[model samples]
Target chain A: AQSVTQLDSQVPVFEEAPVELRCNYSSSVSVYLFWYVQYPNQGLQLLLKYLSGSTLVKGINGFEAEFNKSQTSFHLRKPSVHISDTAEYFCAVTLSISSGSARQLTFGSGTQLTVLP
Target chain B: DVKVTQSSRYLVKRTGEKVFLECVQDMDHENMFWYRQDPGLGLRLIYFSYDVKMKEKGDIPEGYSVSREKKERFSLILESASTNQTSMYLCASSRGTSGAKRNEQFFGPGTRLTVL
Candidate 1:
């Protein structure tokens, strides 16, 4: 079984300031990580994913995250945020095992980012 | 671009009414999913179909059923609408991922259903 945890429920930051959204996961086997953003009344859009190799992953809209294996965390970071960056962000995990693998994605509760000017 | 389309933007139904939510994907993806979004809870999967007539129950499938008679379409059924069932329904699709293929799911605009 796999589960995702997003520590922060809401994050408020002034425009042009940096922000970090924390995520953690627990799984018995190797996993794939993903981040998604949802605007008002719209479906989620894929931000980025960490499949293998490089731990540091870059995503759209000047956002990036680092996958820390030791901590079991995949935190999303933005050097600076814009008013348009205010939205709900989610962290998801899928087990990538061979043979009888579950392709289903388990998602976090969500973090609401509010960028105020 | 991958496009996922839902049958309605909004719907209103009475209690005990049977409801159907239709979803179609144009990307020829092999897997389709139905999820419901609630405040602070994110999205909870109701059902998913990996191929035509193939279905799998997700984390929350108690109040819902699904149908996938064709490759490109998936339908979510609510046997009896209730107030708790009123939420934003989302449809998503992705190419079947196997052996390290990283396929991201594409989502629809969403259907907000109100059950009275």
Candidate 2:
């Protein structure tokens, strides 16, 4: 079994400032990492994913993440943020189901990103 | 564009009432999943189906059941809805892969179920 840990429960940042949400995971085998964002009342949408190659992974909304194998971390970052970027972010790891028949995603608690004006 | 649609955006039911949450995907995906999102718990998978008539239990499947009669539709069933079951229910689907590295999951808007 695998698990994800999102360190920050809430992060408040001013508009046009930079931010980073930390995430760590524990797994024995190789894993795929993902970041998803959720608005006030909507379902989650994929932000970015780190499957293989190029440790730096770029995603939508001017966001990016770096996968660190040794540290077991996939931290999401944004050079600058906007008011519209306020949302709940999640980090997830893919768990192989039934030995390659299907895959299940195990998600972290989540971090509420608040972009202040 | 991949689109996953749920039957309802909001649902309210009484205790002991049978509740059904329906989800449909237009992209002809091979796998569908049902999950519940809580305040602290990110998303707990209840059940998932790889193909028609095939279902697998996820992490949290105690009070939940699922049905996948057709390829495009998956329904989560609660035989007796309880207040504890009140949460945001999200449905997602992805292309089933045997040896692929990753399968991006497309999620629906979600149904906010309030069990009274």
Candidate 3:
């Protein structure tokens, strides 16, 4: 089984400031990592994914995440944030290719990013 | 762009009534999913179908049922609408099998259902 933990429930940052949202996971096998963002009254949109190679993966909206195997973490980072970035972010994980089931993604509780101007 | 469409944007239902939420995808994806979103709890999966007439229970499937009569359409059924069932329901579809590179699920706009 795979589970995800997003350590922070909420993060407040001033506009144009850097922000980091922490995420960790526990899985017996290799896993795929993903980040999703949800705007008010809207569905989730994929921010980025880490399938293979490149520990640092860049995503849309100038966001990026680093996949750290030793730390069992995939933390999302943005050099500068905007008011439009205020939304809910989720971290998710699924078992790697070796797992035949094409394991369903398990998501964290989510972190609400509030960009203060 | 891959589009996933839900039948209703908002619905109001009385207690004990049967509620149905429909979702359709134009991409002809092989897998479809249903989830409910609540405050603080995020999105919880109710059911998913990998193929026509095939379904699987997700994390929270106790109060709901699902149907996949065709490849592009999936429906979520509420046996008895209750106050607790009032929530934002989201539907998603993916293009390929579970482990494939196209595993990213494309989501619909969502439907807000209220049980009175």
Candidate 4:
């Protein structure tokens, strides 16, 4: 089974400031990592994912994430944030085929990102 | 673009009453999931169906049941609504691939259910 853990519960940053949301996962076998963003009163949208090859993955809305195998982390980063960036972010992981079942995903508690003007 | 649609945007139900949440996916995705989102809890899977009539229990499926009578539709049923069951429910659909690559899931706007 794969589990995801997001270190930060809330992150408040000023406009145009860079921010990083930390995520860690635990899985005995290989796993796929993903980041999702949810706006107020809305459903989740896929930001990016890490499957294979490149460790650095760029996503929509000027956001990016790096998959670090050794640390078992997939951290999301943004060089500049705007007021619209204020939202809740979640990190998720799913077991690879070599492990067991790949149907369901294990999600983190979530990190609330607030961009102050 | 794939579009996942939920039946209700907001619902108010009384305790002990039966509640049903409906979801439909336009794309012919093989997998559909129901999840609940609460404050600080993020999203917890309630149930999932890989195919019609094939259902699986997810992380939190205690007071919930699911039915998939058709390939494009999935339903989540709350046998007895409780205060704790009041939350935002989201529906998502995804296409299944054989490899380890994660498939993008299209989500509905979500239904906010309140148990009174």
Candidate 5:
């Protein structure tokens, strides 16, 4: 089984400032990582994913994440953030092996990102 | 433009009452899932189905049952609603293929269920 741990439960950052949301995972096998964002009263939407290839993966809204194999981390970062970026972000992972169907994702507890004016 | 729709946006149920949450996807997706989202707990899968008439239990399936009579629709049933089950329930669907791009799951707006 795989597990995800998001180190911070809440992150408050000023608008136009940089922010980073930490995520770490534990898995015996190679895994695929994902970041999802959920706005108020809405379901989650995919932010970005890291399947295989370059460690640094860019996503929508000028967000990016780096997959560090040695550290078992895929922390999400944004050089500059806007007020619209305030939302609950979740980190998830699934095994890389071929599953017969869509593999189940194990998610982190989540981090609430609040952009301060 | 994958769209996943749930039957309700908000639902109120009394304790001990039967509850059903329906989900439908129009993109002919092969897999459907039911998950509950609570504060501090990102999302916990209750059940998932890969094909019609086939269902599998997920991590937290103790208080839920699922039905998949058709490939496009999936339902989560709570035989007796409890206060503990009050949360945001989300439905998702994904392609049942063997590639990285196809692994993305599209989610519905979610149903906020409150058990009184």
Candidate 6:
């Protein structure tokens, strides 16, 4: 079984400031990591994912995340945030190469990022 | 662009009413999923379908059911609406192919259902 923990429930940042959202996971086997962002009244959109190789993975909207194996962490980072970046972010994990129903992702509670102008 | 769409953006219903939430995808993907999002709890999978007429129960499927009569459409059914079931329902679709892309789900705008 895999479980994800997004340490912060809410984070407020000034526009154009750098920010990082922390995420950690516990899994017995190799896992895939993902970050999703949901704007107000909208569904989730993939921000990025870490499947294999290269610990640092870049995503859309100038966002990036670093997967640390020893730390069991995958933290999302953005050099500079915009007001449009205000949204709820989620961290998810799934077993690598697993098939069928086992492919379901286990998601963290979530982190609401508020970008203050 | 891959597109996933839901039938409603918002819905209100009284308790005990049978509710239906519809979802459709234009990507012709073989996998469809239904999930509910709530404050603090994030998203919980209710059900999923990998093929037409084939369904699988997810982590939180106690009060929900699903139907996938066609490749591009999937439906979530609430047999008896309850206040606890009021939530933002999201639908997603993905390819059945191997590799990471298969798990990269494209989500709909979501349907906020309120059960009174």
* Candidate maximizing lDDT: 6
Task: Provide i-RMS per model in Å.
Answer: 1.7, 2.2, 2.1, 1.8, 1.5, 1.2
Local error of candidate 4 at residue B62 (angstroms):
0.9
Which clashing pairs does model 5 show?
A: none
lDDT for A49 in candidate 2 is: 94
lDDT (Cα, tens digit) per residue for candidate 6, span B1-116: 99999999999999999999999999889889999998899899999888899998899999888988999999999999999999999999999757777788889999999999
Q: For model 2, how does the per-residue alpha-carbon lDDT over A1-117 read when each residue is reduced to its tens digit?
A: 788999999999999999999999998888889999999989889999988899999999999999999999999999999999999999998854446423888899999999999
Task: Tell me the deviation in Å of residue B96 in model 3.
Answer: 1.3
DockQ, cand. 1: 0.70
Score candidate 6 by TM-score against the native.
Answer: 0.97
Q: After superposing candidate 1, which stretches have Cα over 4 Å from the reference? A: A99-101
* Fnat for the candidates in order: 0.70, 0.67, 0.33, 0.58, 0.63, 0.70
Candidate 5 — which residues are off by over 4 angstroms? A100-102
Candidate 1 accuracy as TM-score: 0.97
Candidate 6 chain B: 10-residue stretch with minimal lDDT: B96-105
CA lDDT for candidate 6:
0.93
Model 5 residue B59 CA deviation (Å) reads 0.7
Q: Is candidate 1 or candidate 3 better by DockQ?
A: 1
lDDT of 3 by residue, A20-114 (tens): 99999999888889999999888889999999999999999999999999999999999999999999999988787643245467789899999
Q: Enumerate clash totals for all models, in the order shown.
A: 0, 0, 0, 0, 0, 0
The most accurate candidate by DockQ is 6
List of chain B TM-scores, one per candidate: 0.95, 0.96, 0.96, 0.95, 0.97, 0.97
lDDT of 2 at A96: 41
Superior candidate under TM-score, 4 versus 6? 6
Q: In candidate 1, which residue pairs get closer than 3 Å at backbone N, Cα or C atoms, i.e. clash?
A: none
Docking class of 5: medium
Which residue runs of candidate 6 sit more than 4 Å off their true CA positions? Answer: none
* TM-score of model 5 (CA atoms): 0.97
Pairwise lDDT winner, candidates 3 and 6: 6
